[model samples]
Target chain A: MPIDEALLERMLLRESVSEFLYREADLLDERRYTEWLDMLAEDYQYSVPLRMNVAFGETDAREETRAGREICWFDEGKETMSLRVDQLNTGLHWAEEPVSRISHLVTNIRLDAVELPEVAVSCRFLVYRNRVADETDFLVGRRKDRLRQVGDSWHVVRRELLLDQSVLLAKNLSIFV
Target chain B: MTTVEEPTRTGAPQVRNLVDVKNGEISREIFIDEQIFKNELENLFPRAWLFVGHATQVPEPGDFFSSWMGADPVLLTRDDKGELNVLLNSCRHRGMRVCRYDEGNTLQFTCPYHAWSYSIDGSLVDTPGALHGVPQQKAAYGTNLEREKWGLVRAAQVHNYKGLVFANWDPEAPSFDEYVGDFHWWLDNLADAFDGTEGGTEAFRGVHKWRIRSNWKFVSENFLGDTYHGASTHASVEAVGIGPGGKGKRRHGERQNEGGFSKGRMKTSFRRGHGASDNLAYEIPYPEFEEAELDEYFVAAWEKRKEKLQAEGRLLGGRGPATLFPNMSFAAGFPRTILVAHPISPTETEVWRWYLVDKSAPEKVRDWLRHYYMRYAGPAGMTEQDDMENWDYATEASRGVVARRYPYNYQQGLGQETASDLDGSVHSHHAIAGEVNARAFYRRWAEFVDNLSWPELTELARVDDRATERDAVVTDVAEGVKVLDAVDVVDGPPAQ
Candidate 1:
């Protein structure tokens, strides 16, 4: 009976995490940037490292540019993210001024670790952005996250994304993934 | 009478007709037409001195960084003798790309297809990228294949100007020094550290490269004295300030009391198409940071640089958002960096950005700059993201037949140029708004695309009648903008 209860606990926790990620995606897609910002803890760190093309065996060492050390696409804490949100609201950030229609689909969710109060997660993201007349981009990537429990909800403390691209295909990364 | 020419169509008149400097009009065909794109790749790129990867990228012997010179892929390598080399990446055999990896360390690049090899190792070949081995040499060709002359094609000339490597495919074009001229002042600010050490900077390990659907010229024009766009195009970023001074400050983080952004910033337009947004006279100090350590570090650097440069009798300005004609562009202040807009087609370009930092910077300063540079430029930067939107949409909308008929205007500050102390260059004292740089750039572009002989190009630029004519009528600046007539705005910096 105890073993069965433990398995059920794991299942419930996975569902909760999945629901939190899905709700986060909904907020982003709905352009409720302020609400989405609330989902992040004050100490939240987000990074999107540049992917490199290296020889087969050298990938483990050189494939992804380091987050805090090397030059990456987006590397900063909540303050920078808040500024990015401010830029979006200005109605003059031409890249997102007209408001890009974005669909952030988070799937393949896996609970990597759970030390209580904090949980590590892994997920795949397929973000589709279309704007203006015909500009379209599909950014597919693997993402890792560290979430902290807050009573009934969860707050993202850290996120690291590894886009499966050597050279970014999109013209601008104006939307949050 | 500018009209679009379909690719392969003949007798379309000279490219000079498409670029009318007198009227300050440039036809849209050059940016959207396929044939003109081919002409640019074939004629202009080969002759122009282009910025390749830096020497630090390949510091160790056998290290390589795959780069692009215009449209051609090149392997920037360091040979066994510890010399840098720029070789065509295509294999000598089946023309396969010899190195597909973005960067690595390898003495020889063996063709993945046929296994034919070329070596930069001293024991294997006389020169770097020389053909070292051929699979089945005697079995397949029976001593008929001459490996001596079958090596990967090498760049005709490669010059490492203070660690910023540049290459040209035309051996007769001009020496890098001759080509750069007094524009080296801008290059000096870019390549050197903030403390005025000669070539004391190196590129960061990661490069931010992304594809944008825009003609390459759009990228070049924006940086080449297009200060006019900053207000309207970057209003959002300005409102949200991502500068060293942190939020609510100007994005450039310029000192608080500097008369509103454009006060003394003048446009320096060179006869050879190289251009800078700020002049040597405009010497605005570097930005102020909110963090005290950052302020201390930069202020100390400023003092050191002032002492060193003044002692050397060099003007302490000309830190530019400048373009080194034909495509390389860079900015030296507020997050120093290099950008190369490689032509993919008429309407698509691959933009590569490399950030620079002083080699001697402390860990804190280095980290702060690295973070600042990431947020300030490139496709992902708040300031640059909007630029891509404009560039892409401009290229897309201009493809309509009705839109191509209306030529873009480059008439701002038309025919208003003052002489400079630097040779073969002029200054547009509009301070804030001037298209003189773009006009000069387009004129030089036409000459290169038309494949004018090196002598003709040199002679045309040596004593440019247009600049001279402006000099003659310098006082006739129509808009009543202060035009410093017959003034050497750059004063006189000791030539290197």
Candidate 2:
């Protein structure tokens, strides 16, 4: 099928993709990180590029940069992402210690395009993180993802996050978006 | 004892009495006193070489970044002429901050209050009514009102040392070079690539800023010498494979004392409150690469530069952290990170951190370094969260009147650093083990806080070569070395 026709078809499946996203958010909020990892395809590329506060005329809305031109807050492959889970498994990574109470609110589901095995989806997210006694952070951003169908389940193949705040308001982003 | 009096009006304690480096004693009041905080803002911060953003941050003309010099909001900008200036963000008319955004490119800043606009170079360009005499200023003061004096206040001095921009508020203060003294050589190592290539070091985009409920001094002083807290504070770093304690692949955090992979350690202190503590032979702990060829390129470059660096004494070992007195500090090794601690109040500090790498390096190299920086030491990095916890509690505990009465003991390496061949530098043989640099830091800090004139402060900054010598053996070479080196040395530890 032509790319445009395929995208139109994917747009028809937006309901299913939104359901998949909500399910993913539920997994993350429950601290089911390993199970969350299971939702990823083998060739997953997860990244949270840095956002900056620049003049409107300077660039796009997020004022982000190309991959090599600037750096990101979180840019990890499947191995690196797995390593993060491994670090958490040690039960010592103090950043995650005391265990964060997170509520991942995913909304504004929009279908962008689709290829043979993957469907591109866009959405808005607000990850409310509360830790220990008083520390709390609200990370709101837009995420673009490529979800691939593996049997009956959707696996995240690629994801890019563009946060609204230039300087991260949270201490550490130990939780995935 | 030669006592340094505080400003008589504020009733602050005598500086000499406030800190006793010889006895390793420091009054907790210095960390929690409101009057002393006010004094520091007036006397110390204005005179110090406070770190601003890097020159590369505003590479294009009209580009700007807003930052704080102490508590004052300032705008760092590159004008149309490509000249750099630090302007007070407050408008002269209503004291409204003219620039509200964090960073941007603008030919001129217009005050939102009354539409008064000033050029990027801080020249008052338009007054909205100056030509037509239609509104506020002209109607109130007539034609005699001077517009020149109403321009945005600019920093007294602005200069870039190897692309690191710094600003001072006091015109009578010593030059940046004079203020930093010999610490410039140490700073150069962090900002420059091994080849000394032009435009080599550039801070990666986006800064990590976090507020800590602690005195700014605690953070800067930590970078100076207090590696003692590492073992307990960062015990988790090892439990994870990222640190040296584990027997895994060990890509980074080379475990300074686990197997004795180093030769020795040294700490250097200079005049004007600048000091650094580092390993004798520290290398970048982790260098992750996608291609083996890129890895080979880095190793080859390092091998070729090692001898030259050794000759210059810059290649002394695994790098550690250093502070340029008052507020600015740098992790003087791999994936070099620079930090500025802006004192917001007596018990609150806002810290700004940036990681720099070789600009000429490959994309993957820069990417790898940034990833390590964010994961390991950035605001949310593994190591930094541990430090924030400590600082937060320390500040909270010291708020009590009883706690403020006691002195924080800094006697770890008191009377220990001896004469060294490094030219006016002294080293504690135990390397990461002692509090040598911290003592010197507080001493110089006391000197800066003294009610002395500019000339007197300059005179006092001169180091006495004979004063640092001690007839004592180094302690904790075994324990201290391991605890300190277990974390980031290349990019100063996350203590700040």
Question: How far is each candidate from the true structure, as Cα RMSD in Å?
Answer: 3.9, 5.6
Candidate 1 Cα lDDT to native = 0.85
TM-score of each: 0.95, 0.84
- lDDT by residue for model 1 (B1-496), tens: 4674443344333577799988889999889988788888888998899999889899998999989998899999999898889999998878999889999999899999998899988778887888988877899999788888999999999999999999999989789999988999999999899888999999988999999999999999988888878877888888888888788887766664542233445678899999988777556577778789888888898899999989988887787789999798998887689999999999999999999999999999999998888787887788899899889999998999888888999888777676666778776756556788899999999898877889999998897565666445443222222433223232111100
Q: Please give the C-alpha DockQ score of model 1.
A: 0.89
lDDT per residue as tens, model 2, B169-269: 88887888777766676677777774545447887777777667779988897777565666556666545544322224332444444322343455665
Worst 10 residues of 1 chain A by lDDT: A1-10
Off by over 4 Å in 1: A1-3, B4-13, B259-261, B470-496
Q: What is the lDDT of residue B260 in candidate 1?
A: 24
